[model samples]
Target chain A: MPKLSYLKALHRALRDEMDRDESVFVLGEDMNFALTNTTSGFLDRFGADRVLEMPLSEQGFTNFATGAALAGRRPVVEFQIPFLLLLVFEQITNQANKFLLMSGGQRSVPVTYLMPAGGHRPGWGAQHSDQPYSLFAHMGVKTVLPATPTDAYGLLTTAIRDDDPVVVIGPLACLGVREDVDHADLVPVPLGKGRIHRAGTDVTLVATGHLVHEAIAVADDLAGDISVEVFDPRTVYPFDWDLLAESVGRTGRLVVADDTNRFSGLGAEVLATAAEELPLRVPPKRVSRPDGAVVGAAPELDAVLQPTREQIADAVRSVLKESGWGA
Target chain B: MSVLDEVPATEADSAVPDSAALYRTIRFIRRFEERAVELVKAGEIRSGIHPCIGQEAVAAGAVATLDADDVVLSSHRGHGHLLAKGCDPARLMAELAGRATGIDRGRGGSFHPSDFSANVFNATGTVGHGAAIAAGIGWAAATAGSPRVVLSFFGDGAVSQGALLEGFNLAALWRLPVVYVCENNGYATTLPAGAAIAGTVVGRGEAFGIPSSSVDGQDAETVYAAVREAVVRARSGGGPSLLEMRTYRYHGHHTFELKTRLRYREQSEVDSWLGRDPLLIQAARVAEDERARVDAEVEARLDEVVRFAVASPYPDPATATDHLHADGLRPRPGSAR
Candidate 1:
């Protein structure tokens, strides 16, 4: 078994997909130098034609990808900052996303919007720091947030292969997470499925992106006192509700850890669904950022605003206490 | 290629007929807007339209030279462009009235009327996004080796958008068949071009090495001639062309402007633009009897269109998400299951 890092997985997926499909090409600003490292051997492996370096025009290049996708090419666009996705949000949602439906199913836009370093990158502050996966999910765009290296590789491959527009948010915090797997098993993981990293019966902790790893750690820390089921939903939009239902059915208590803001965030959606339909023995708890909190430049101000490991543990403990189900 | 290598510019072909066509387009657009306005007031149309009253020639001339197979990607202010592309006037009226038999099954009211079968893609409510989609359609057509082209129509405000420029670059780079037509109708809502834009629209296209030009958008013939050449260039593998047709919006930027009363432009400027009315110019080109015949036919067609649209049933609420996905996969309802 070989160990693969998250960034390497993305690079491998791009290289492999380009080689597999001639129509698959990589484009974005500073891609030639592999600025994001997601297209790291791309320029050399596939040549500059396939690995295009665009100017600092995020909106322009975003549509350029749409144009390329329309030409029967699968374009994988890498954005260095999470906020860049916001700048080109209209291009993706209005143009690429609606092309198929507006054309009455006459066309398909298979463009991959890969935010390699999504979410708050410490002192990166207001403009650059953002985790906007929920925005895409709300717009009915297929959105994925892979937690680990294998999942990153798998999801990116699946996104490229999908016939619709997909947004893959690779959290800056999770990019270094490595996993050991057989090279042959580096296969495409189907979207809308959940991977139960740690199965438990006391509480179901649904985590997304880098929060999955954090949940895994919290579950381990509370291993002796509580049995926690940490589930990683690879694709957030076409969420694996069936899997969540089954997990929560056995546990009867749920807690969600998400990276977005508290109001109308992914965590809120999960909590709402749990309360509405799920048979929860206790009120579910969610660990997320404060309402409409734009992360500031100061490290301490940022640290207070973002969801922390302690907060995840507290949310888990609260859910467990509400159910009175700790082992 | 030299400017001479292309179609030679002449007063007969370049200025007069061009101006005449511009007037015709403007006239058609003006009359269409007036008729639509009357319908809105009469409650025949539910959602108020963003009239293209002042920017008629842009639609008339640009679409005048397009083949029936050529595609058009329009904007929110797209009714004139759609009409100019030979869309059924009645069905268009029916569409504004939210009729089932309308172009978009009445799902896309006024702002998003689409006739894909006729290659008229609807105006995406998102500003400046159509260019990329147009580029995509062009790329598809070019790769298929089809002699067809795509005309992406947008306003001056859209030119500031990066996506439109991206569309320009891709079309120019791959020589994908497309014509980027910008109808500089003075203002994007209340935001004037002078206040928002940093450089000229034509200069942006020229930077991409796309053959860029400026035309009198108020004249239909000018629009038609420029578009015709661009269409020829695209069909002949000469790639994309960017034409900035300078014009003014005769009416409010949108119907909402009626309430805001944003007086960004002078009344004199509006009066001056009205002097070059597109419909009157085009009507002058034809005999009195011919003009009357066309008018009577258009009026009659609009009547039936209104009737059909009004009588059509609203889509069943149960199937509201019917066309959301082509696979017809209803998103799994939120449940533990």
Candidate 2:
């Protein structure tokens, strides 16, 4: 067994894919120096041709990756900050994503947009902190946010091999998380599959990215009184709605903890889907950042804006109490 | 049948830049556009097109320099580019009519039609974004050890876009084999270039250290000579080059201007540009008998193109989600169940 940190898993996935496929290359700013740590040591191994260091031109390089994909090369574009995704939204969604349909399936843009540190990090103020995976999911782009090291390795490997545009977000908080793993067991994870961390019958707690760890910890703390089910959807766009419905059907309650803004967030969509389609004994609840949340530079302000384990536990208890099944 | 497969071996391998061929190409595009406008009036082609009536030489002459294997990224006014690149007229017309037999299967209408079979990768409606994509394609070709040079065509309006400039920087920095062609038709939709652009079109290229020059876009030979030199440079690994083709459009930006009178340019200005029509300019170089014969041939070809486009069938509504994903993954049915 080997201990694999989340960041190390992403680095390994990229390095292995490049080794496996010559067409797979990395293009981004500061990739030569590996400023984000995921692309570290790639420049020396792949050389300047395969590991390209682009200028500070987000939109240009984004569309450039699309062009490369059109020419039968798979490109993985790494962005340093999460909001950089917002800068090239039109390039990805409008141009790259629509090429397959616009060309009448004549072309497939196999470009992966990887955000190394996706969510809020203390001291990195408003401009850099944003979790925009929901935006990509809404635009029908395959969006993945991995919660664990093994899942990160699997999803990123799958994203690089996919024939369409995919956005892989490595939440800032999950980068340091590590787990013991058998190296031989590492494999590609299929998209749209939800992983159940812990099974219970009283309530279903749906979490994404970093929040999955929080949900699991809260479930352990409340084991004496309540029975909680923790579900982590690795990919958000082609969401595992079937698995979600099945879980909620058994638990009879739903609560979502997401890091995205409260308005039009993934949590909102999850709660809405559960209420409209799934059979639930009580109303579903969501714990998310306030509407139009701008994380400040201070640690306390950032902490207050982020969804905490206490918030998840509180939401879970409220749902249980509403269903009149509280211990 | 694929249009590229039907192309003559010699025609696909090399473009001789002869007078008759250039004249026929210009005339074919000019009449094709006129007939397309007529189709628009008849309510067959849904939207009005950006007619490249006077700017045919830029498309005909520039495309004449490239081999069939080379790629082209075109702009909104791209019918001439497609036709000159050897795209079948019937399929192009079908696409404009939104028929199932279109080059893009009617998925992309007038603004965005792509025919990968012809090596015309795509014609984006977005003004300037294609340049970056073109650079990427060039970079990919270089990496693959292919001797393919990508030509990116855009309006003078695209010179000011930050993305296009960034593309220039990347292409020059990496020495990617791409030719950036700017057709300065003096106006972008309605705004004049003088008002929109800051320094100059060629200056934008020079600032990026890319070898650039301005050429008379009205004359087919001049445009051919300039673009041919750029293409040669790119193929020889000399890096990217920019050519500013000073041209004009005889008609309004779109066919809707036929009914709505948005007075931006003087009628005299229009008359002056119409006088420099690429079709007539090339028509003068050929004998009267040859010109008349070419005119008759173009007319007959366009007649067939129109008939074929109108006779094609529209796609079924049940299959509207087709081609949305490469893996044929359709969206969930209307109901949640």
| Candidate maximizing lDDT | 2
**TM-score on 0 to 1 scale for chain A of candidate 1:** 0.97
Tens-place lDDT digits, model 1, residues B1-337: 1101112233222323444334434555566678888788788787888998867767877776777688888888899888776676666777787765666656677887777656686577778877766776676677566887889889899988766777777778778888999889888888889898888989989998999999988767767788888888898999999999998877787776666788888999889989987666566776777566656655555566556666777655665565555456466554445
Which docking category, incorrect, acceptable, medium or high, applies to candidate 1? acceptable
Question: How many steric overlaps does candidate 2 have?
Answer: 0
Candidate 2 chain B has its poorest 10 consecutive residues by lDDT at B1-10
Can you tell me the DockQ of model 1?
A: 0.29
Candidate 2 deviant stretches above 4 angstroms: A324-327, B1-16, B333-337
- Candidate 2 colliding pairs: none
Give the alpha carbon lDDT tens digit for every residue of A34-82 in model 1.
8887877778888876787777778877776776676578888888888
Model 2, docking class: medium
* C-alpha lDDT score of every prediction, in listed order: 0.80, 0.90
Query: Tens-digit lDDT track for model 2 on B1-337?
Result: 3222333456424535667777888888888999999999999999778889999999988988888789999999999899988888899999999999999888877888888978999887778999999999999999888999999999999998999998898899989999999999999989999999988899999998999999999999788888888998899899999999999998899999999978999999989988888888888889999889878877877888999999999978887888877777666666776
